[model samples]
Target: MLKEETVRALEQTARQLRVEILKMLNTAKSGHTGGSLSAIDALTALYFHQMRHDPSNPKWEDRDRFVLSKGHAAPALYACLAEAGYFSRDDLKTLRRFGSHLQGHPDMNKTPGVEVCTGSLGQGLSQAVGLAIASKLAGRSARIYSLLGDGEVQEGQIWEATMAAAHFKLDNLCVILDHNGLQIDGEVEKVMNVGPLGPKFLSFNWHVLEVDGHDIQAICQALENADETEGRPTMIIARTVKGKGVPFFEHKASYHGVPPSDDELTRALEHLGHS
Candidate 1:
């Protein structure tokens, strides 16, 4: 569980992550912004308050693993990793640049802290299931966490992986769904609705929890509860706004993958009290 002081610290870290995310997106000129911002708080809570990871020993066998299945939100993951001391914050400016480790989508082979190379939607849950099975077979107590997008869950593979995870009874695995209700084209319901997400996961024999994605306290609680759950994988359905914190962008479909212009960035930073 996270102490009050730790939660405060994480709030600061989340703010820093948001700043880095904006800078990185501005530098890249091409990346998902809305989704990334929406998931930042949850990522902050996990890397800063919940996960057992080692920055100096990225490949430590006993360390917890995290997979950003919603690969388009790589900026959030990269920012969290940097704040957690996995890499230098300077590297963030190079995001999506030619030959930079910070690619548009996470590349595990190139990035120190990323566990899986994910960008194709619906594949991350499968990868997490494999990691969980491996940990169990190796007699390791480390847990595995995967963050997925609600729109991505429309893919058939996710449900298939969900079935496999329950079949294997990988209680050490936790899946978080960023339910922001927006996709690239338009609202998630208009693109390809994946509603009743909680019931769907429950029917698949997984433990399902719901929380506000922006609430760090709720995020920590869901994670802690996942640790206590037995005999099944846990899925957290986190309802979130597309562009949390930035008022002009919140729930705005145009900001999904669009970067803020110089003027817009300035206004956004001002709104966030960065100025």
Candidate 2:
């Protein structure tokens, strides 16, 4: 259990990550907005409080791995990486620029902290599973984590990887589903529903836990439960608001692939208590 002070600090970090997510997207003028904001709290809990990593030595062999399988949400990962000291906070301003390392999608070859190139969708879990397999083979205790969008689970590869994880009993692996319910087209259910998500995973043989994604304390507890489970991987179904924090953006599908305009950015900042 987290102390009250620790929970408050994590909440503040999540808010700051949201602020940076907006700042980067607004500056780039192109990037996913809704998904990034929706996933920042989990990303925050991972980088700041959960994952074992060294920003100064990103390639350190002992570091635990994180794969943002929903690679469109790279802005959130980039923001957390910057906060984790993987790079200068100033570098965030150059996101999506012609020569920037912080590209629209996560590029492992280009970005210092990214575990793999993603954004093609549905491939990130495969990559994470492979990493977990390698960790087990090497007799390393490093755990692997993947964050998937609810819509992204529509991909066949995600299920394939899920089966592999359970078959291999990758207890060192944990998957998070950002169930914000909105995708580029609008509601995920309208596009192609993947509801009854928990039951599906349970049938696939994964240890499943559902929680309000924005609740930092509950998120922390879920991570703890994942750690305690043995001989099986864990899946945390995070029920989240598509565009969290900013009122106008919340649950709006239009913001999925859109960047906040200068005017919208000002309003967003005000809503986030920055103005």
Off by over 4 Å in 1: none
Worst window of 10 by summed lDDT in candidate 1: 1-10
Per-residue lDDT of candidate 2, residues 103-182 (tens digit): 88999999999999999989999999999999999998898999999999999999999999999999999999999999
lDDT of each: 0.92, 0.94
Per-residue C-alpha lDDT of model 1 across residues 34-117, encoded as one tens digit per residue: 999999999998998899999999999999999899999999999998888889999999999998998999999999999999
Cα error, candidate 2, residue 112 (Å): 1.0
lDDT of 2 at 205: 95
Candidate 1 clashes: the total is 0
**lDDT value, residue 253 of candidate 2:** 97
